[model samples]
Target: MPTDATPRPTIYDVAQRAGVSKSLVSLVLRDAPHVSEARRDAVLAAIDELGYRPSRAASALASQRTRTVGVLIDDFHNPWFVELLAGLRSVLDPAGYTASVADLALETASGRKPVDGFLAQHVDAIVIAADLAPGTLERVGVPIVVAGLRELGARDAGRAVDVVAGDDELGGRLATEHLLRLGHTRVAHLAGHSGPGDARRRGYESAMLAAGLEPITTGGGATTEAAGYSAACALLEAHPHVTGIVAANDVMAVGALAALRERGLSVPADVSVVGHDDSPLAAYRYLALTSVDGHSADVGAAAARALLRRLDSPDAPAHRELLALDLVVRGSTAPPPT
Candidate 1:
């Protein structure tokens, strides 16, 4: 009684092909605990033979759950994001979920909006890897896991959200302490933008104060190389005795290197420098910049796991995960000039 014009293979077709009921096919697709291993294998084999693709939209309409997570990042140009994505994918892909990345190009300022497209797609949850704009969280209906920024409070919709962040303060302390240990008392910090920058700056100041050394800070907005170069110039002019610099991120540290070279200063000879976020570029033989590892990949995985836990129980209490930091000593740091 099958018509030639019948639509593409559905769960019913897969069930018939596998000699099982439609419910069994459904169970197999959902990876339900009740389904036997043999039955699941048979259903999968039948699906492969029939070229049946599960309709995501249809499944969502029936079960009111879309096994997808929305990820919004502040910027994509930074290599740190690539590592973060690797971590996120490792956790989500094995769990039968997909992450839709939405990059808000902060450079243009116009493209700096949250994942409105993903929200329109009705993803099951959202992970924000950057600092969101004011009032953006108010509109989000699904469970949210915020990484990178830690200040997002409960939403107006009464939906609790989880936050994941690196120990940036500790990272800053480590970087400054490294320079201090190398006998550089006149150290300066190239701080990032508002959120993470403030914490790092605080750490730098705390460390400097503990050493009885005056703390100097220059703005390295958004952790960019250009900003680092400009900030380094200002810091050098103001504090000529500064023999050490702690940059908020690797990009800034690289910029500081260029600035120092342009001024006829040799790295680790005239000055020692340290950067945060031990990005891949920092390890290059030419750069060999010492940096603090923010463990961005671990943070991403933690964020995904937290979101999954929330998806399992929407009423679960809010959680906060802070990844540990590590200091990577490299060629960029050395004892101050005697």
Candidate 2:
């Protein structure tokens, strides 16, 4: 057995063991096409036997590619991004790309630009999962894939960006329609100002209008749980007759729950509630929030694939993909109280 001090194996050793030229070993390392199958197999076998690991730094220097992707998220507190990151890794890992994660919350707290951090890492590409300041992405000079966001306005206008997102508007409509189907006549929306939040609000309004019911909406600031709670409180104060609430996301839905509890209201019994983003919190026995599943993981995977394609064909027309959404029924929604 080799001790900790044993020197790591190198490509030269691998080439010698396989009795192949170093250039041939390099081609095999890159999985390059047109290499003879027999030579490729020999190189791979020798690499396995000798435990030779390619130096990513050296490879990057030669190819001008770091094989790293910067993933920017809104907040770590939100569980929605957990599945999204898993999906991104699913495709990126197999493609030999590493995901470097950063959250806007922390970046702002530290008083640094999120894009600056990603650029400093020399990432080959960037996957945006959060909203940035206007023009924050200008002149990034890197391929960008907007993940899980239906709209993004901050980017280099001259460059084409790939977008892979869930149909948030449809998801919002589905959640509101679910509540409407559950016999809720007085439905209010806990709104947020973000792109997804705005889209969801529009969906709720559309459903209510279609049903010929007056729509009540409140909260147009943050999408945090605190924001949800505050908005719910304000909504209940102004429209206490509301029988249902459609929050922008699961965290906000939880906030609304707290607001309901304070007013001695029971979920689905007093007021049925539906939330968007079927995050892990929605599945908790205590919450059991009926929510819209935007398939964020699938969005992440699709975004990664788009990023790879962008890398391969930089001049191709920008890819825009909108994934479908579904709703997960839980304990939070039911027929309105009699």
Candidate 3:
């Protein structure tokens, strides 16, 4: 029997085998609108025979639109981000746009700039949460929308970049006020770090001042369970009289609950606690955490919508949207002991 013959194919080989011009082959590979279906089909068939893959860089240069948005999150494992992503997908999926996510774990020691990777991919736009590394805006060539974050004074190439955020300060105030209304005078706040944390802290202070009470903050970094636990322990040690606590986020609140339990304290009795973010775990029957709803889903959806608008009209005016916050009273909170 004759040995079977096989041929390795390149773009040039596909062009020749397809009996089409190299330019036509290139256009088909790039999915350029200028090429007709008949020629595209012919080029595709030749590509299948040769097992040829088009160069992504060359194709991207030919087609200006990548149909992809870059999303950079501070941490990937956070449940808040998961909910935000769902909201983002609800808006972007129907519009045929996709997102590329970059997670920057606080523990990562790598000096690699994740923003550079997104730029290298030629993503059409970028959505970044709070606490982004400095200089990200300067390097990004495409439209950038700040989600759940604030950019103090970054130039936007004369085109206004959009920002979508929740009223974290208001949420903080609401949480504090709720605790105050429950007759808890010595309420301690487990404040998180940076951005949202600062805003919420301000609100807590404002609410306390308005109520003619002093604001006490147990400063903690990030909204982690460990941070909450540590902050709660510190608060209990410093101010044993404190009867209520408002954590910056649900994670910290859960930690506070655990801390209270470890101390042989009961929720809503020894120390009523309220958390921010209203994460899914907050609603569990066992936890029943009273928390502030930052409406992360709405913020995510608004960010996606803002990005699409910018993509459609790059020169459109810069916009800022602030979503509302609601207080969800659950079983975790109660009036201080008489």
Candidate 4:
């Protein structure tokens, strides 16, 4: 090992030298469990050669609890995950828990299962912010908190998954209500194919029925801007009189804008638009889209709380929380023109 006088290296440096992810290094250092001998040896060697020392927070977690939580995201490409991650860290860091993020996109590309990676590190708990493949959590012997959009848990009796998420269904209803309140009767929905997407579409349909309007839906595909654009084109082709649109998410909503512009339509002038997630993209001066705020940050914090609660009482009654959602009116919505 290097002397105390030697410059200490960060975990990132150790990860680079070890040719492994930072979470793997953390697992090696803690000696929590389940790390392969080769990877553990490599990490140990890197630490000795580079004079790596754990942080004060990391050092404080010397207990039965590994004090680590694995955060699984659906895809790293989506910007909405940024705020949710920040919220998780905000509470986790202060509570002396390290949050390590991974994504299903990367896992599937490498032919690795989502839980396999976390299980290898022996994470004390897991936060599922994505809809994982079936069986990903079937036998995962750890406390799990399903955060954000998806509803997931164990199928077997005696085990339950704790869930904390924004009211996505309510968000859809709120978005539609805002457009309806603005005198938009010819409203269409840019659909997304996911648990959250399904809930949002149901909300839109319910609101439309309550208003004595028909629910026109399109794009039960991926949750991307491309899908949004394709959906918008289909909607416009079928119902050229559509005066408003409710997208599954902010990125999808942005996609709708491009399709609208191509058809000689202007936002809020020719057709009002609304989006979900209230991501940074929605607040851009150019987009300025009316959107539903899911309070992702708050949901993240609450999810952490739920995980901690579960960790303390594994046999306790299952906890489910859905934060209220609100619509943020911006420049993207206005009354339909005569």
Best lDDT goes to which candidate? 2
Per-candidate Cα lDDT values, in order, are: 0.82, 0.89, 0.82, 0.88
The C-alpha local distance difference test score for the whole of candidate 4 amounts to 0.88
Tens digits of lDDT, candidate 3, 1-338:
11124443568898998899999998887778978778888898998877776776445663577788888887765677777777787898899889888876742346766676677677888888746655656745688888885533445334488889898899999999999998999988999986888889889999999999998999657678898999999988899889999998988999899889888889998789999888888888999999998888889899999999988888888998889899999999999888
What does the lDDT read for residue 277 in candidate 2? Answer: 87
Off by over 4 Å in 1: 1-63, 106-112, 155-158
- Residue 50 lDDT, candidate 4, scale 0-100: 86
Considering lDDT, where higher is better, how would the candidates rank from best to worst?
A: 2, 4, 3, 1
Superior by lDDT: candidate 2 or candidate 3: 2
The C-alpha stretches of model 3 lying farther than 4 A from their native spots are: 1-63, 106-108, 151-153, 156-159
- Assess every candidate by TM-score: 0.79, 0.81, 0.80, 0.80
lDDT of 4 at 240: 95
Model 2 residue 9 CA deviation in Å: 30
- Return the top candidate by TM-score: 2
- For candidate 3, list the clashing residue pairs, or say none: none
Measured on C-alpha atoms, candidate 2 has an lDDT of 0.89
Clashes per candidate, residues 3 or more apart or on different chains = 0, 0, 0, 0
Model 2: residue 11 alpha-carbon error in angstroms: 31
Q: How far off is residue 162 in model 3, in Å?
A: 0.8
Question: Which digits, one per residue and each the tens of the lDDT, describe model 2 over residues 294-334?
Answer: 89889989999999999999889888899999999999998
